[model samples]
Structures are given as structure tokens and as C-alpha cells.
Target: MNNGTPHNTTGTMSANVSYYNENFVANSKFAIVKYSDRFFLQACMAFEGVSQYIDFWIPANIPGDGSIIELSLAANGGNLASYSRFPDGVALRARSGRLLMKYDWQTKRMEGNFSFEIQNGSTIVQISDGTFDLTGIVDGVSNSSIYGVGTFTAYSDQLGSFEAQEVSIELKDRSHVGLPNYWQIIGRMEKPEFPHPQRSHIALQVVEHVETKIHTLGNNPDAWASYFQEPDVGIIPAVNGTLEFTTLPNTGHTEGRLDADFRTAENVLIHVSGIFDIKQAKR
Candidate 1:
């Protein structure tokens, strides 16, 4: 989405950390256009003085034959967002980057990893080990399912994606005796306190799946629910169609897909499948 304005596209991007607390999740809309005599992959998220984005207009192009294209911090790129109104913030105004990207025409998907820097004033934010994926791509969608910053998609017909407008990602405990599940990703539309905004309002949680730890949470996928606070829509208690988790086995990460065919109040249903890549945030 451009400036919180929905665009039909997909872009999931995030950084490790920003010195000034940047909070702009790169939405799913990476377009390769010819600007002047070169081709640049224009994928960025900047708005209202909050920016945590990846905009690279390089000499490289995405291969349609399922090959890898490298993009990295080998180059350049901003912001002001405190620990309050935003969950994340940018510390630089101009910067460069390096990355490895790929696009599979057969699958209509794009995947890549990167490391870059954004220098604002005398401060510089060094973001490392960043990655993203784009699916259900079109001319580009802004309001579609943007899990974190990437335009997300439903793995199944029953599942769907959403934008929390305001969300919070907390590394709570899934207390399981000794193996207390370390990741209980709590993403809500509720604006958090000073130090509790979702990934500092910068990194939108990825749409990958975080395997469900039954011992920690529960096995009842139908009862698994999620809802919007303001819109007054929530998951229907007994209306879940499919609920499953594909865990990362021994890692502090997991992937999940759930489709609740019902809601708490209205006939609203909540469907979403994605990854909670909170392992890095906890570090």
C-alpha cells in the first residue's frame, strides 16, 4: 500500500532494528519498471514521517526462469518515530543495500533476503539478515492481505490475510511446564504502550506459519480465534474450519494457518495463515 492507501499488490519486508524506531513495513508491491536507461525494483513503504522500507533501483533484474538475483548492502537510503506512537522507526534519511532476489513465473512468487543501512543525521541504522516473500501478486494490491509488510496470501481457500491497522507483537510465553513455548505471538489492533508497540511499529510480522505448540496453547483449532476491535468483528467460537501449525522443530519459530468460519458477535469470520518470525526480535 502507498501511504496507507491500499494498492492491489504484495510486498513483505522488514529490518532487524532501526536506531530512531522506524515503523513502516514494506507492503507487497515490488514492481520492476524502466526508469531512464535502467530497470529498478521499486518496493518501498514510506508515509507520514514513518519509514522502514527497501527501495532499490539497481542494474539487476528479476529472472523469470526461477533463478537467483543478488541485492545487498553493497549500496544505499530515513525517519522520526519514537517508542510511543510507533512500534518501529527509521534512523536514517539516505542509504544503500545488497540483496538476493528471485521470481518464479511458474509459481508467480518472489523470494529474497537482504542486509542494508539507513543513515539519518549523524545516526545510522544497520539492519541485517532481512528477508521477504510475495504471493497472490497482481498489478499490486495495497489493502490485500499484508502479513507484516509483505502482501500475503491464503494458503487455502478457507484461510485469509489482514492488516491490523494497529498491531502489537509480543514475545509472551506459552507456558508448558518446562518447555514453556517461548513464542506466543500476540498480534492485535490495540496500540501498545511506549515499549510494547508491535515490533516497535516498524517490522510487520511475516506471513509465515508458526507451528502451533499444542502443549502450550491448545489443540482446539476451531476455538482458535482472532478479531478486529474497532470494526467490532471477531472469531466465532465454534466456527473454525481448519486450524493447523507447522512448527520449526526445536526452534523459536513456527508457521500457522487458521480459518474460523465464524465470529464472536456478527457473522464475521477470521481466516489467516502466516509465519510469526519473532525469533530475531527476541534476540
Candidate 2:
């Protein structure tokens, strides 16, 4: 049984599936089905030159809208399974794995990053850096029609380089009593890390009639960035850095670059530099 559109529209699913030390940029299809009392979210993908496909099933009752769901066989009323086809046309079921899924109810889209292991007798297939995005689950109309593509990458000496699996950028124009009237750019990057996920943030303010080629970290009050690692390592503020905007903030979109250096409480050096292209959210 299906309430709304059961299958996804064409070109609505984007996914990358990796296993056996090989990566596949697959064409995917997704569906929302109701069986008995539970609603299931299912997806299947097919790659080029291979008879292999990966499938996943999850309960739709789990909380969404920027909430994280850790998938397990006993999760709610549904389980996560992956079927991979081999060269000899033999299919193997994933034995154990970890999956983290995030979704937005208003946008009708889902984002997932997962890694799992499949063992068959003496052979083990390792799946790593697997990611997928499924959109237009309700009416078969893409959410990207209303929202633009946003992506960013952050690199540091301590944490290496990581691309944000999900990115959000917001623009604010406000005037405080004591502070100057300015336009603020706020950005967040969500990185997929098993067990504990990490987030990086960028904040910059541009006051009216402030002319500067580069903004320094300590010298500037309106520019700053931070890294957040919960519990073990708290928020690490930038010690020294520079921020430059290639494309100034506007009502439509903003493009910029940031190079920041941070030092954790334990004296670990983190030199972060990356570029961002984000669309302004509708107000």
C-alpha cells in the first residue's frame, strides 16, 4: 500500500557506492511503501558494466528533519540490508555494518552515509565511504527545484581534508544597539563520522563601509571559525586565520574561501582552508 507516489521520479536519486576497493557512481531509484502497519523507505542502485546493485530498507517512522538515525537490524520495525552481485552472478548479503541517515521532512529528502562489512566464509567485502541522497519521496517532484546545490570542503593539518556531506548557509541582516549594522554570513558543514559526528562552522560579518582586502582573525571582530568535536574535545576556536570573500554575500548566493588556524586545548595544530559555494536560503 502507498499513500502518495510510491516511486521516485527519474533523475532524483544521487548516490555513490563503494566496495572491494572500487567506487561506483550509480544510478539509483527509490520508493516509499506501506506494508501492514509500517511504512518502509527503500532504494536500489545499478552501476555501469556490472550486474551488481545495492538495496536498503528503513522504517519511515523514525524522526527526521535534521535528526540522526543509527540503523540496525532491530531498528524500529525495519532492518538495513545490502545485496551485492559478484562477477560470477553470485549475490551476498551484508552480515554487519553501520549506517547513519539524516532526513528533512519539509524538503522531502534523505541523506545517508554508511560503512559496512560483508563476510562470506573466508572472503570479506569492505564497504567504505558510501553515501546517497534521495529526493522527491512524496509527490515525485524534486526538492532541488526550490533549493540550490550547496557544497563545501574543510581541510586541516590535524583532521585532514573532508567534504561536507550536508551543507547549509544562511544570511542575516541585523543591527544591534551597540554593534554596527552589518550583514552576516553563517555556514555549517556536517561531516559523517561513525559513532560521533563532527561539525565545522564559519561566521563572518560585513559592516557597512568597511573596506578591507583581507580580514584577520584576532584583529577582526566580525570574522571567526570553529571546529566542534563533542564530549572528548569541545569547541576549538581559531587562533590565527584569514578570511576572503571571492563573491560577496547577496540575497541570491555567496561564494568564499577561508584559511584558519586553530589550536586545541591539547596544543594540537589545526590549519584549515577550504572553498564554499552555497545558495542563500529563502527568508
Which regions in candidate 1 have their CA more than 4 angstroms from the true location?
1-7, 21-24, 27-52, 60-62, 76-96, 106-108, 135-283
TM-score of 1: 0.34
lDDT of all predictions, in order shown? 0.37, 0.53
Name the runs in model 2 displaced over 4 angstroms: 1-149, 191-195, 208-213
Angstrom error at residue 140, model 1: 12
Candidate 2, 89-144: lDDT as tens digits: 22333456767888777776777777655543355666666776666554323344
What lDDT tens digits, residue by residue, belong to model 1 across residues 144-259? 23222212223323322343343223342222212223223334333444542221111222222344333211223112333322112211122334444554323444345444
Per-candidate TM-score against the hidden true structure? 0.34, 0.41
lDDT of 2: 0.53
Model 2 clashes, total count: 0
